[model samples]
Target chain A: MTAAPTRLACFGGIYSNYLALEAALADVRRRGVDAVYCLGDLGAFGPHPDRVFPLLADHDVVCVQGNYDDSVGNELDDCQCGYVDPQDNHFAQISYDYTLAHTSAEHRAYLRQLPAEIRLEIDSRRVLLCHGSPRRTNEFVWESTASDHFLERLCREADADVVLATHTGIKWQRQLAEGRQFVNVGVLGRPENDGRRNVWYTLVEFGGDQVQVEFVPVEYDFARLAREMADEGLPAEFQETIRTGWWTTCLEILPVKERRRGAF
Target chain B: MAATLPVIDDPRVPQVELASFDQLWFQVAGTLCNLTCHHCFISCSPKNDSFGFLSLDEVQQRLAESVPLGVNEYYFTGGEPFLNPQMVEILIATLEYGPATVLTNATVLKDEWLQRLADADAASRFSLEFRVSIDGFSPETNDPIRGEGTFARALRGIVKLVEYDFLPIITAARSWPEADEARVVGEFTEMLRREGYRRPRLKILPMLHLGAEVERTHGYRPSERITAEMMKGFDRSQLICDHARIVTDRGVCVCPILIEAPDAVLGQSLAEADRPFGLSHGACYTCYQYGAICSNPSAASGGGHAARPT
Candidate 1:
């Protein structure tokens, strides 16, 4: 007997927006996506890591460790984002120094237990699920990075039908050399480079000769999250950035111009 | 009638930046976030300890190792960079060798921290910039994803930056459509102006799929891999990680993003990462696509765009 071709919804970076998560599941049902590949960072920068992680863990998601996940899983003192700064405010420094006093040993153990990368065969193609790059769980891949760098990484470090990544919180999709593909599922927990407070996610469908990656958006209540952060005693600035998408911290690596571009 | 197949694939389409910073990034902060949002890329709650922090000594060692090679920049990111215990010390250390930037959710802005950052920036020959992430204009617009009271708090924080005489660029993710960009910015400006912030600058970023975002939406496609043919005649220079290397406590990683990859570890030095590398991930494709078509075409970004702005 023959089997039906598989359909996949390759998403990543669900930073804890339950409303958006609900919408994504609805999308999967509507699209009849057979499988869902969660690239990693199952929790970070949002209010309900516990709520979200349990839900995702229950699903048949192909999960990997995101840079943030590494921090959470390990109970590392810092996020290890490597954000270069001239002065190093206490917030980031504190984040780096923080320990897992509140979380259970089980959750910390599980995060460490998560794989850096996951590989699956889809449409006769080897799909690699990684938080950053395949070899590194915390690497951040962005559009500004070079091609030969990527080509060399793909050709030399590892090979796959497509490399799915998260972090940088952006939605992007591109085709690479040698019939390979790259998809940035974007951040469902956050906005996709716009000023409005909506979220983004992607849906991918594979056909006999064609493949497609779709970016999906959702709406949720932000006040609840802010209140949660407040209730949790999170930093006021960090809580506020969630609402505004603006960083209170100084990014030493950003272009001088990327500094202070948005007023609100 | 002229036939326009909609250019299913735009031959002359402007490209998108998809390459990973491929460098190994540090988990400067684990799940311990300054703020908790609904749609955090990695649902980082106050208690979520996922990644660990590198010691100042480790960072110093990494810096020394990275200087020999062309690797020149460093970035700090996390639940809250300021939240890290040794953040100030870490920045002081990183400035010795390379310029640095810190990516933060920007809800809390302390006058002392900004003053210190400014002083250090003034003191250092290397550059320092801040990329603040504020999702929307009003509480109604932004609070849904970030959390309750976030809009007011974040705006107040931004206002505080203005008090520090800073016009911090507001980083907003593009949750809205292509059409709403200007109004968004305009509204943002009006709000900031009312808050005493003038000369508003904005950077709208697309969302990334990972962590909490995965639950927020469906993921990618089977066909989204980067093919060998995708690189034909493409300018690989736009991908900065090719020429750049990141120094971490563990060693000199290829780029700041992929610290876990052994190959990315690149010996104990940046000089080692200088060796040629193959574009290995799907993020590379994004680098090519947008690096081809997407530019900060916005008038606010009057200057030519940086390969990666943040």
Candidate 2:
């Protein structure tokens, strides 16, 4: 069995923000990691969706298929982000339409061929990399809603000791039974709902039966991204999230605990 | 003569297998409710004793059983879950296990109960969701359906819930046409905002045409049953029976919506109830059309097309 990389830099939901992606990769390079992986969602909610593809290719970041990737790849009608509120879906549709229209055919093909999940072994512990949950591509798996047993079952069913997922856009970690753990590696696409203008990525390292998980904040030129979004005719709400570090759209999917923390 | 309803044993009716034991619902207060709502699918009323409350011990037993099956969350429902004497204790105990959501009319709630629950929620790692059912935006529109004075009482309950700092998901069964959702939801949000709920979370649901609802309006047409052909290319996980089971005083049923149906009872225990359920009823058609009707917006389970926005 090929041993998993000892130190890995994992990024989630680049969302076409090439600036943040570039910043995150450079940060990862300076800190030094054995490998870099992206947890899908390379497009949506950002400007010029095609720009991030070259960065991923240049950096050799392995990726899984996120719901957005699947939709853009297959030329589907929606982002499949699973927002049930009209306003949320309306904003999601705007973002999806923009991303779909902007993504290159070659990039879409690359997204089309990406695997749903990747499995690795790290010092006798199995690690699973997935976009949302291991089972579904778009499942949110918010911090407040995922029960311990639910995550335990997810890991057990996927035959993984450590499961890393990102689709909810927020980062959280829970230690489960025995030495098992689950981590939402956060996102490089946008700031978490917290009022901070910085995106995040996770660094996971394993040594001597101990797993160290660190969330590293990646700060980029938010004003530049917001300007580009405005230039591209993206929704003001998307630009607002970039500039203000607070989520202005897609608020319906948040559970009470997570929603309570946001400025909204 | 009336038309014969479809039976479960029919081979042509599609069967939905239990995909995962993700949501476990408890008919905590059984069929007894404080007020007789015109649209109640189960015809629950204060005088009805057809079903009885599940004791806290009983709920705990089921909760214990649920853990082994890897149940994700617990939902408490009924005529009104708060009508049960032990509803507060049951919820407090459930917070220890996982996230819990209780669907209530909110009229019978006590400050003490909300206070205890508020404290319990604050301490738990999981969220305790309160799905408060209020059918219409105004009392004139709501009172005729729910009962006289219910709108005011329920509004007070919502204020109390908010006072305790709980962001309750205001669930309203769509009493108006689907096209009016935006206006109605806007009005509802404004009402909640004026009543001191700064940020309101709302979920609009389709009415299940059963029990007293049939008398209120016409029941489901015979043509509304789920045929096997409809199962093709359709996501079965959209149906609650495919992923959830309800624990009642009698036994474990397939889904919360079908608890009153004779065929709804799958088995005596969660383990035994882990069988495929036949979608033979007209209510199954509603479930088929509107997926995840019983779940919170946070718990949507699929990755395909976007759902119809509420």
* Top candidate by DockQ: 2
Tens digits of lDDT, candidate 1, B1-310: 0010011232332332323333334446544687876556546678766445667877776656543322334667666776877777787776665556666666765777788877776666555545577777778878887888988887777777667654566777666776887787678778777878655556666554334544566333334444557756554544545445555445555543333333445656444545544445333444444441112211111111111111
Candidate 2 lDDT at A18 equals 95
Calculate DockQ per candidate and list them.
0.03, 0.51
Report the Cα lDDT for residue A5, model 2: 78
* List of chain A TM-scores, every candidate: 0.81, 0.98
The native-contact fractions of the candidates, in order shown, are 0.04, 0.51
Candidate 2 chain A lowest-lDDT run of ten? A1-10
Badly placed stretches (over 4 Å) of model 1 are A1-5, A86-102, A148-152, A245-264, B1-310
lDDT of 1 by residue, A1-264 (tens): 123236677667776666567767666777687777777666655554666756666666666766556776766656555342323235555433333344456767776777677666767766666665554444444443323334334533566777777765666766755567777787776554345566776776766655677887766666677777677666686566667765554333233433433322
lDDT of 2: 0.88
The structural similarity of chain B in model 1 to the true chain B, as TM-score, is: 0.74
**Residue B27: error of model 2 in Å?**
0.2
Model 1 chain B: weakest 10-residue lDDT segment is B297-306
Residue A138 displacement (Å), model 1 = 2.2
